[model samples]
Target: MALRLEIFDLQLFIHIVEVSSLTQGASRSAISPAAASTRIKNMESTVGARLLNRTPQGVTLTSAGRSLLSHARQVIQQMDHLAFDMCDFRGGLRGQVKVLAHTTSLTEFLPQALSGFLAAHQDVEIELQEALSDDVIRAVSSNEVDIGVVSTPVTTGALWARPFGRNRLVVVLPSQSEFVQLPSITFADTLTAPYVGLSAESALNRFMARVATQLGGEYRPRVQVSTFEAMCRMVEANVGIGIAPISSVERYVKSMNIRYIGLADSWAIREHILVTQHLEALPVLVRNLAQHLADYAQTHLPGPVELSYGNP
Candidate 1:
């Protein structure tokens, strides 16, 4: 007998394996326990293998089940992407690309880059979200977003990453502050003074918090503000020294009475990268948007002059 499978069955199997309880999985799939059990039995019979090991505790995937789960996820992802593409034919929109990035890219870089891309591709739309670097990587790995822009080095296990831009952290302080005269300063030294901080939830603030913890200290901000510009203004009033990206710092330094100094820590200098599951496997429109972002970064962003970036 030839093996045959249904998409609904595959999706049901995924749901069941994820939760480890057939009843709960059936509830999630909107099918009754009895019907779900029958479907699973049918699937097992067709595949000629036992898929699950069930007990009163719950269920665990057998070796055959693990194999099916992997293929099922891939199939689901492909179907989702296919549906997204087919929608363009039914609707007026040509395509939509989902992108995730950190705060610096969202605020300082992507606004201008996306504006140009949007202007050129009038029929295409982009959905953008701000997240921390780890969250960005997870989203890209799970196929939750079409692309991700992240700072810091990433563990390239299964995902593809290409250098997107170069940026670094800088200390923004009042021009007359005594610390401004120093040639260079570590991140720990900046924490000695009361500092203006970005919103507690922002990616940069969280990153700084982690760095502080690593150095056996704490990040205690004098007052928390929302934007880099706002933080700069707070620094101008001598509220406290603030840390921000060089791109944003340069934009405000001439007008504000604040000066920025580069952080001495090696981690302060970041190589932002574009992340995806598979570059060549992306849809034509998504691949184009990714290329446009890389090209825009090369021309408009600053990076190490000696090294080349982006995919070869």
Candidate 2:
């Protein structure tokens, strides 16, 4: 008959090798030291070899024990992987997904994708919030949100992140504006121009304001509207020009008499990232949604991205 192995025995042995103390390993395994000794003895008897030498200070592994230590570690590691890997095969889906996204992602891409996700996942509830990039990252890091969509990729310690999409900033102008005649307009040149802005509470508005101030200019909005479409409307009315992501204003480009000018600024280019804690830790429904979002990004956007930040 083949000797049956107990996982706890292997774990106890590995921990003993790690700490050099049978008592400490037994404590970690939640077994009494006497019971641990019996288990080790039984394990040794089954293997037909003495495994360790008990000492006054601590325990030292015998040559046989040293030989088996590497195998024990491999077995424990594989068991841990198995516990997590079995979850991958389960097809269970149901949970709430609290999502926080920055302004560009909230306004441009996530709506359609989220709608599709909602349609597919009837049992899953989604609570979405609009926040700035930094705030979204913080929320995910702090476990306040299940997922975050950010316009710019940043260091997310202990979090898994993937590229979601792009949000290239563009200038919305009336057809007759002289600046619109140019292929692209500089931020400094547009700072002096009449601007239709979003609410002051909006991150994009704050970003533009900060940029203008940094360039030794002020953002004087002719009118402040809540939505990108409203900003485009105000621009179409020749009230003021607006700065928005091309994705946000694409629908209005053909129907509305407006010009989409690229912003000649490095910051104009923005990459969107989906960030969250470990995907395996999330509920089945949430994990599925995350995978769908990643898949969508791969197919629709540039490509798939998997970032495993090794350090916390």
Candidate 3:
């Protein structure tokens, strides 16, 4: 009879080899050191060979163990893939899709998109994470997430980016603020207002700086905030005027007493993109989701918005 192998046992063995200490491996596997030792012994008994060499410093894999380690890892990975594939087959559109997006997309775009998607296909479960635009691209490139929605340009050579929509950089002010009545204002006028800027590290911040310079205004902001939502809140509280993507403003519009005005400058357009790594064989659900997003983009973002790739 073939020996019954446990997935946990295989995971424990791999962890032991990687960590080079039974204590460390046990800690990682959430198993007691004694239990870990017994499991290794059982594995050796079944295989009929010693798998590790113990020294004062640490444990090293034996020749036999070294030979088996690679195969063991491959087997574990294949098993994981098999489980996902089985779930996909059984659930059909109900299978989970992991997605990563920036805060703006998460707050503004995904809520509507996911609602429509779920309404159409009740079986699909989406696992969405909000991250920075750069982090979103990295997640998609590594296949950690099935899709990434970001404001920044795509950088991964192995991934494909499709233009999803354009977001306008609108100047947000308190409802009672004097700037609310401005027909159209230049970037200089915006900079002159008490500005609550997004983080200096953000792509929006860089774009704002470039536009400010073009309009011959110094890009010195009075308050620096970490998130677009926070910036809008600050603006609503009369802390200072803020410039952010219109989508972000739309997200907090109901709760905040702020008015968003479009900048007259042409440089205020920010394009949003959807990115995915090239799949050898695309999954049916993923293909359907991609098509749905493409159709939505075409329908909503009717006019051309300026697009920049891999820019600060």
Best TM-score goes to which candidate? Answer: 1
Cα lDDT of model 2 by residue, 77-167, tens digit: 4454454345546643445677898788787778877888888656567888888788888877755567898875466778888888876
Candidate 2 Cα errors over 4 Å, as ranges: 1-92, 302-312
* Model 2 global lDDT (CA atoms, 0 to 1): 0.79
Q: List per-prediction Cα lDDT, in the order shown.
A: 0.83, 0.79, 0.73
Regions of model 3 farther than 4 Å from truth:
1-29, 33-81, 175-233, 248-257, 261-268, 305-312
Higher-ranked by lDDT: 1 or 3: 1
For residues 1-312, what per-residue lDDT tens digits would candidate 3 score against the true structure? 686668898889989988999889988999999999999999999888899998889899999898667767756654644555666667656566778876556656677776788898877778887777778887666555678888744465667667777676777888888767775566766666788987776655665676577767778678889888899889878998887776667678778888866777665665678877554434666656766776777776535543221111
What candidate 1 gets wrong by more than 4 Å, as runs, is 1-74, 87-93, 305-312
Candidate 1 per-residue lDDT over residues 107-131, each given as its tens digit: 8778888898898768888899888
After superposition on all C-alphas, the RMSD of every candidate to the true structure, in Å, is 6.1, 14.6, 8.4
Please report how far candidate 3 places residue 233 from its true position, in Å: 4.9
Evaluated against the true structure, the overall lDDT of model 3 is 0.73
- CA lDDT of 78 in candidate 3? 49
Candidate 1: residue 168 lDDT (0-100): 79
Ranking, lDDT, top scorer first: 1, 2, 3
lDDT of residue 167 for candidate 1: 81
